[model samples]
Target: MIEMTRVSSPSDIIGIRDLQALNLKQNITAEEAIDQGFLTAAFTIEYLQEMNVASPSIIAKVGDKVVGYALVATKEIRNGHDLIEGLFDAIDKSAYKGKLLKDVNYVVVGQLCVAKEYRGQDLVQKLYGHFKDCLSKEYTYLITDIAQANTRSLKAHKKRGFQIINELVYGEVKWDIVLWDWNLTD
Candidate 1:
């Protein structure tokens, strides 16, 4: 039985990191990435621990084994990481059209990955749904970027109600900045 829940222990952190490493290793080609969404950036144990400190990541577990994870990042937390900071800078100038992203109550899905066995099960939507359930009350939106080559991820996000708000080049890779707005009052 697969269960979706918040990260609650130290071992869950390690499992998240290990899943990330496995996804990175498999993300060498667009074809592979299309088959299964890939992670572009790597996160250290310390970084994961720190990010989780602010808001615990969502994890999918099956009988005590973690099969997937989605990391969360806030504005203050993004500032502590150079890569995330750069992404936010680009987002501020491009996605928000010169408006500061910090002005919005949003969260970044720093990374998301599901194990091979867990693919084709709608786990991505399940994870994002859990994220929304836990955060939408406090945040107006969720933001993240997918590599231009990652059509699978792009399509999945779109299917999940995320819109492509902007496009930018980072680390020499083209990215599609996506946003899922929870607040519809506007």
Candidate 2:
């Protein structure tokens, strides 16, 4: 059985890093990336450790083996990583430009990936759902940016109710800044 939960132990952190490495190396083709999703940027273990210390990431595991993960970050916690810090700054500027997302508490989905063997199993949605269940009360939105080339990730995120809130180009790559409002009142 697959279990989705927050990273809580050293083994969980290692598992996430291992799975991230595997996914990064496996999905090389554009078709493969579009079909299974791909992660371009890499994170050091030290960086992940700091992120977990601030806000634990979500992991999907089966029998003690991690198959997927979604890294988490708050506004204050993201400044430690240069790339993420830049992204947050761009997001802040874009948010200000639109005059939306004001005075709202939010969390960033820093990175998300699934192991090649686990791609079709819906682990991504499960991980995000569990993360939201654990954190939505404290955060008004779940935000992330997806590269324009990453169609699979963008489609899946949209299917899960995330909307494109802004667009920006950074590092020569176009990104869609997506958001999921957690505080929607029906």
Candidate 3:
């Protein structure tokens, strides 16, 4: 059985490897981690510091072994591509019924991953369930961005009721970024 749990520290190094593994499994480039020799190792130390002090990062484990992780944060965007900026504008317009996002609360899902062996079993939904149970009480909105080419993740999120609200591009990498939202109010 799979289990979801909160991360206690950013320096909780075991999770760093799990996150790296998940990234690799999903075919996401871990260039930043790979190019910087000891940087990946040091990132664990820093991650612990960040999570220990920050309010939104969480990690998943199954029986003492870390298998997946996620991070959620609340913030506003002031600048970005046209589609991105427009999406926020749309969110702001709807969030307030023509008001602003200043009064609304949003939970941004920064990262989410599952073990390869566990992928097709709906573990992703369980992870989101855990996130929703824990975070829904505090925030009314959840948002995440997926690489446009990542059809698997796109389908997964869609199955969970998330809607595609916008699309944008990440500079040099030329990756297509698709924004999705889940309204927890209902």
Which model scores highest in lDDT? 1
lDDT of 3 by residue, 1-186 (tens): 566767664433466455564455224455522321111111244443444354545666767666766654444322323333433444554433344554677656645666555557777777777778787767766766665546667777778777765444543222222333345332
What TM-score does structure 1 among the candidates reach? 0.90
Which runs in model 2 stand beyond 4 Å of their true positions? 25-27, 96-102
Error (Å) of candidate 3 at residue 178 is 6.7
All candidates in order of lDDT, best leading: 1, 2, 3
Number of clashes in model 3? 3
Error of 1 at 51 (Å): 0.4
TM-scores of the candidates in the order shown: 0.90, 0.91, 0.66
lDDT of 1 by residue, 5-98 (tens): 9999999999998888888835456577667768878888998898999999999999778899888887767777777887777666653544
In terms of lDDT, the poorest run of 10 residues in model 3 is: 33-42
Q: Write the per-residue lDDT of candidate 2 for residues 1-186, one digit (tens) a residue.
A: 888888989888899888777667343766777677788677888888999998999888888898888999888677777768867877676662246554567888999988887778887788889888989988878889999888899988987788888887877879999988776531
